[model samples]
Target: MSTYQDADAWVAMADRTRRSIVERLAHRPMAVGELAADLPVSRPAVSQHLKVLKRAGLVCDRAEGTRRVYQLEPAGLAAMRDELDRFWLRALDGFKELVEDEGDPP
Candidate 1:
């Protein structure tokens, strides 16, 4: 039960590494070491990225036998999706109006 801000989720995903992390987590929850091994970065770098993701509410972690496994936060992602949907709707509405008005005499 976490409160996620759509803006933070958008900003957090702006980084390539963070986006990659999210992609990995989308498939399965993983430990920091596992992610680091797959990525081109070090374990410490992965940990730092996880910290940012956690703060942005894009990911959450749980301790399991001395390891913290990270997974994607659906709630945060849903918020982001809603925001993007709204943006696209507004853009399309404006475009529709502009196209319709083109046939009118200025």
Candidate 2:
């Protein structure tokens, strides 16, 4: 939609720890500690990364007892994918227009 501040914010969220967290939770929800156990980051670090992901709208969480379980948010990912798709499509269309406007190729 419109424009994001920069693709970097979302791309940065795609880093190793974040991706691992997202992948782990994509199938099922998990607590931060559980995810931290599987990752190299400390629990707090995992929580911090989760905060970033959540801020970017890439992940969502729900209260389960006293803990918060995190899961991937399909709508956010879809929005990001749509933006990327539109960007590439427009780029390709421009390339095509340029080539066509050049007359016959040498």
Best lDDT goes to which candidate?
1
Model 1, 58-99: lDDT tens per residue? 899999999999999898888788778999999999999999
TM-score of each: 0.89, 0.77
Compared with the true structure, the alpha-carbon lDDT of candidate 1 equals 0.89
> Roughly what TM-score does model 1 have, to 2 decimal places?
0.89
Identify the runs in model 1 with alpha carbons over 4 angstroms from their true place: 1-4
Q: Residue 20, candidate 1: how far off, in angstroms?
A: 0.5
Query: Between which residue pairs do clashes occur in model 2?
Result: none
Candidate 2, 47-92: lDDT as tens digits: 9999888877788899989999999878777878888899899999
Any runs in candidate 2 off by more than 4 Å, and if so which?
1-11, 98-106
Tell how far residue 69 is off in model 2, in angstroms.
0.5
